[model samples]
Target: MPDKDAGTPRVFLVRHGETEWTISGRYTGRSDIPLTPDGEHQVSSSAGVIVGPGRIIDPSKITHLFISPRTRARRTYELLFDESAQKMIEGKSETTEDIREWEYGAYEGLLTAHIRAARKERGLDKERPWNIWVDGCEEGESADEVSNRLDSIIAKIREIQGPYMHGEKGADVVLIAHGHILRAFAKRWIGFPLSTSLPMMLEPGAVGVLSYEHHKVDEPAFLLGVNMGGSR
Candidate 1:
């Protein structure tokens, strides 16, 4: 394998900016709510910090974009990359349902506390409180189902990034989606089961990087910490 950091391909996971549901702590799956005014500002401000040249996620380094079909995600992409930057990667970008938010089903638009209360009222989770990772949503996707979905995406991403492990260029990929789905994708990226309870969190409008250890494609890993004093 090449040097640990040489030309290693990376996946940048971006959770969409805040929505009313996000602030309210509601499950926002497939509801299609727009970002709040603060959300728009948040994404725009983030772009200025991380999406510029020599910043954390330079637009020029983005080889491909896999964006969720949700309006909030698409709008995040719009505000994230300026018109010039968008034009730069327009041909390589794709809007995909594969990366959409986790389906919440009956739990949609309900807060976690309320979901647990409802489940308790219905005699569910008496063994323990409701846990999305382990118990999943009623009438929605199970942990295994979500794992299967994300595993397929990881396969496609690896295919695109495998060739670049040896310092090849143009292999940085970006995924724009929701909080739970992106966190789930990170777990699946590292071969962890959805019920593993890794305690990972991706804040709205924040960016996280997934890459391989020692420039080896088979050794998938993620940056636990980074110092951004200079060029990314």
Candidate 2:
């Protein structure tokens, strides 16, 4: 396949692999759940395909690694890279609270059905229903709150990618975090409102790419698809 955006800086949004809560459809926020055995396998398999030279996410080309301060995300990082790649990542990685999962608060660890039922009992969603994008959790981070922090991260990334987007090499940034926040990050990356439902899905252990159109930092956009061929 031809290189569509060759030498352009990119942002890789990686969602942590499956966990107990993920299987149960629970809202895993501040809770630090470990990845299941299958989760580890999932990320490792993904690494084989994407984390190599000339692949979608070449570890040596990664300039910055912003990871969530959660156990699952941390472990996912470990599984996503081999010893050599991890060595390449040194001095470029930061474990930050800014990329942590959305603070679920009252709804933490609760399934969506249960959360809505509880809210109904409390007479909270009479007009419509509890929607995280609009209603937010009773005590959790609002959509605006999530957007604010993600904006900060995006600003930092744009600064890092500024001089490199123009055909310069080795400036890809990677973010390892949970479902909702990564989706929110993508939305905010393109200056979209969080209330605008994300039509794209970032599955566990799946990777999403964001980059500039025409190799211009001012033209940030989602890299909708890439064909990961057999090996690097």
Candidate 3:
């Protein structure tokens, strides 16, 4: 476990750009989907605005990057960082399964409406609506399971930032992953349960910041006013 110190170390959560399933609002889990042309362009254009010298994610200060193994996520990672930053991140980055999208299982590739209709037909939750945070997906990961996995990763991140807290001025970590998992990660980062946290909307190519309030690691909080900088 890392020591909770008064330092401004931050974590940047980057959701992958658009994909076929993403555009269609289909549940994409273990399936490896590539980003669409627009997705690539969106991420590519965001690099300068979000990751340059004075940007939210200072490329030079990035200590480590955790990227998802999925194609869309990896591609998004490549597009988000420029060549110089890529070189700096080469040895510090690793592809981890912990950051992959939520496993949709039987609900994979099904749109939200279709899943709801199927659930209604199957006599599941006839009165109430389906919520992934509570109901989760049939034969898939529960919200608690997702929270646990993200907690493990967050612990690792804290461990990595421990030494840098006292020594360096900037020790930033970056995570490039899918929408649901990243949103869940942000909630867990702030020690909030999925059911309790407000619903967060993370568009493709959008970025979110997670850091400590008052520079205390024990006081984790999400940074607000994170503009995507330009049209996506």
Candidate 4:
């Protein structure tokens, strides 16, 4: 199902900037970790890219700016957008359980290297031996589980396109969320199943733009761009 001319929402998805856990390569799932100084600077610098004299972003066109309730995401929204912009999209800027990072559960707080080392000792050496997205969630969700959850969230966004794209002329929507979840969101957006999230490595502090063209019901959504680099 494609979005009707009711509106075409341009979503600028931002993975929350870095944190101490990220720098340390720890699995900070479900943990309330604050941004490191570098993290804060990364997001703050994006503010200049999106706004200001150069003003890459057309402020007047932006409407709904969404964010996870996590401090890291919320802080990014605050820094990237202004107070009034936040107010305009407060309700839409919601904390979605689906938008939350993949629940690492028992693996939380462990580094990839450490996990792999432990796994190697136990003969768990494989690309996705412990990949929660495929196997069962180790004390958490399977990849299918995470995919289904994110599907519902994307559905909600599509359902609210009218108000989300609400603007004097048009609107640009923003979502500040975690890396893994956002990657899953991308997978779902292209009509791929949950397992498709395997290859798309959503990097931290990255900003991706999703654009589409709809002339009628004839053309679905055209994949305008994705995982675009340049501005963090």
Off by over 4 Å in 4: 1-7, 52-59, 87-91, 120-128, 162-171, 215-232
Which stretch of 10 consecutive residues in model 1 shows the poorest summed lDDT?
Answer: 223-232
- State the lDDT of candidate 3 residue by residue for 1-232, as single tens digits: 5434334677888999999888999999999999999999889877867777657777777788999999999999888987988886678898999888998989999988988889888898877878888877779999998888899899988888766654365688999999999988988888888877478899999888887765556777887745444211
Candidate 4 residue pairs in backbone clash: 133-143
What is the C-alpha lDDT profile of model 2 across 1-232, one tens digit per residue?
Answer: 7566667888999999999989999999988899999998889999988887767788878899999989999999998988888998899999999999989998998988999899899888898878898877778899999999999999999999999876566888999999999988998999999899767787899888898888788899998766665122
Query: Candidate 3 or 4, higher lDDT?
Result: 3
What lDDT is reached at residue 23 by model 3? 90
Stretches of candidate 2 off by over 4 Å are: 1-4, 229-232
Instruction: Give TM per candidate.
Output: 0.95, 0.95, 0.90, 0.77
Superior candidate under TM-score, 2 versus 3: 2
Candidate 4, residues 1-232, lDDT tens digits: the string is 6334334556677888899988888887789898888888888787766653214344555556566778888777777777765554556556655577888876789976776667778877465555545564468667788878877866665655544442224555667888877767776766677654447665667676664455222122534443223221
Q: Is candidate 2 or candidate 3 better by lDDT?
A: 2
Clash statistics: count for each candidate: 0, 0, 0, 1
Model 1: pairs clashing at backbone N, Cα or C within 3 Å: none
Candidate 3 accuracy as TM-score: 0.90
lDDT of 3: 0.83
Candidate 1 vs. true structure, TM-score: 0.95
